[model samples]
Target chain A: SAVISQKPSRDICQRGTSLTIQCQVDSQVTMMFWYRQQPGQSLTLIATANQGSEATYESGFVIDKFPISRPNLTFSTLTVSNMSPEDSSIYLCSVGDRGSDTQYFGPGTRLTVL
Target chain B: DQQVKQNSPSLSVQEGRISILNCDYTNSMFDYFLWYKKYPAEGPTFLISISSIKDKNEDGRFTVFLNKSAKHLSLHIVPSQPGDSAVYFCAATPGVGNEKLTFGTGTRLTIIP
Candidate 1:
């Protein structure tokens, strides 16, 4: 079990603006992932943040809309570009520990784009 | 395509009774399954997991049953307690190193004391 934390626990932003959520882990991890949970919906994988490289987006998501940065093994960030009301959801960061198949999640950032 | 599905939206059980949560997956490629419990304003906590090779796995009062032939799995909590009340989510992964996971719509479990 890894201790994960995300900045901007909850926020409200105007449409067209972008909000960047930062994720930090207590220890180094090989893989970090970002997920989105819309209201009354299941969790959807947004992207896989790889250190020193570009992020891998899912089929329905794109890098332009959700750009990610992983500068080190213990830190990463996800920026919701050109936000809209539809983009309002809970964004979570997760880290996979060694020898464990489970991924530990952060408290999650609640973003509301008005 | 929803690879993982939780048909039930909610479930209620009396304290000290058994609570069962069901999940189904359309993808046969998935070999790893996990259950997570979540409370409001908090992140999900890992409960238990089962591998493809095993049909059942147990941890204390929680047991996970996997039926590969039916592409179905279930989590059973025996002697349920009030603290067990939370939203339970089922997730599946294709393999050990696979970073992608398909999650089912969570089922809110309520335990009545």
Candidate 2:
């Protein structure tokens, strides 16, 4: 299991603002992913952050809205740009352990855009 | 379309009894299924997982049973405790290279003391 942490555990932001959430892992991981969860809804995959490469965004999500950066193996960031009320959701980062199918998650960042 | 589905919104079980949580998937391509437990204001913690090749996988008091033909799976927790009370989520992935996962709406389980 990996110990993952996210910054700005909860934040209140005004619409049109941007917030960048950081995820740091204890050890290097091959795959890092970002997910969004709405109230009383299932989690939706936002993107896959890969080191030294551009993140791959999922359908209904775009890079311009949810830009990601993975500078190193153990660190990644997801920025919610031009936030809106609809963008309010809990953002989570996860890493898949090498040689293991299990993925560990970070304490999610709860963002409320007013 | 929801690839993964947890039909039950909530479940209540007496302590020390078995608690079963069920999930179904519409996608036959999903090869890995996982269960996660979450508390309020916390990220989900991985509980257990089963591969497409296996029908049953057990760890401690938790067992995951998979029925590929029915595209269904279930998690059983025996001797349930009050501390086991939390929201359980079921997730599925197509395969290794396809890292994306489809998650089902969670089922909140309450264990009565």
Misplaced by over 4 Å in model 1 are: none
Put down candidate 1 lDDT per residue, A1-114, tens digits, no spaces: 679999989999999999999999999998999999999888899999999999999999999999999999999999999999999999999889546788888999999999
Q: How big is the positional error of residue A106 in model 2, measured in Å on the Cα after superposition?
A: 0.1
lDDT of 2 by residue, B18-98 (tens): 999999999988999999999999999999999999999999999999999999999999999999999999999887433
Q: Give the TM-score of candidate 2.
A: 0.98
Clashing pairs in 2: none
lDDT of each: 0.94, 0.94
DockQ of each two-chain model: 0.63, 0.61
What DockQ does model 1 achieve? 0.63
Candidate 2 CAPRI assessment class: medium
Candidate 2 Cα misplacement greater than 4 A, ranges: B96-98
Q: Which residue window of length 10 is worst by lDDT in model 2 chain B?
A: B93-102
RMSD of 2: 1.1
